[model samples]
Target: MWSALDLLSDPELCAGMSIVDISGDGLETLGSKRHHVVSLYYARKRAEQMGVTVNALVISDDGGDLARYYSKKVTIGSNSFVMNIKK
Candidate 1:
């Protein structure tokens, strides 16, 4: 997500609005969960600083509150949002 934000934030793009769309199950199976959360926090901060909006599409396989998690930790910007698809 950070890399995508970096690419979209390129000065040459001359984009009026930069948006990063993320779709996932919201599961972190590898590495430390703490590290991942911290990384995501910083990445969100970076996106905010870069004037980029971050949105998320969450796939809820177990009827979990993944959309709430994403809304609190992932989505950013005034227009950013998280849409959950429950299975």
Candidate 2:
């Protein structure tokens, strides 16, 4: 992920762009806190490349044995609308 950010250090991706991190644990062991941490790092790196800001979004449920999740927010253009991420 850091490599991807480095590649996008140019001005294009950074223009009016934002990085967001979201976390939810429900599925297999793949769904872990470490994954969220990695996601956050990548998100921040991407945001820095775009000269924008990084927002860390998180949601969790202990009851989520294998079907729980949270989402991140993404806004675009001058209108600044939001889009929901599906898990």
Candidate 3:
């Protein structure tokens, strides 16, 4: 698992600068599982602690309703923040 500090701070090897926000596109399409959702919530929580952001992007072919629904269901117990990326 990658941490916010890992993304925000300098890397051990490659000379790349910053990672900015950690994003996971298509996180849970079917909204059929919460395991990965919980993982993402924890990752975002850690990122918040490190003053970083986590972009959990889930795409929906159903005009974003599926994506929005997926986010809603996953964030229920977590109360994690989520946003829609309009195309």
Q: Pick the lDDT winner.
A: 1
Q: Best candidate per TM-score, number?
A: 1
Q: lDDT tens digits, residues 9-67, model 2?
A: 65655534443332333322434555534454454445555655333222333343222
lDDT of 1 by residue, 1-87 (tens): 878877886777766668999988865344754453437778888998988889999989765578888898888999998888987
As for lDDT, the candidate ahead, 1 or 3, is 1
Residues 1-87 of candidate 3 have per-residue lDDT tens digits of: 244445455455453432333234454333666343445456545555654433345544446774566454433222344555654
Q: Which parts of model 2 have CA positions greater than 4 angstroms off?
A: 1-4, 11-14, 24-52, 62-87
- Please identify which of the two predictions, 1 or 2, would achieve the higher lDDT against the true structure: 1
User: Any residue pairs clashing in model 1, and if so which?
Assistant: none
Alpha-carbon deviation at 85 in model 3, angstroms: 7.0
Candidate 1, run of 10 with poorest lDDT: 28-37
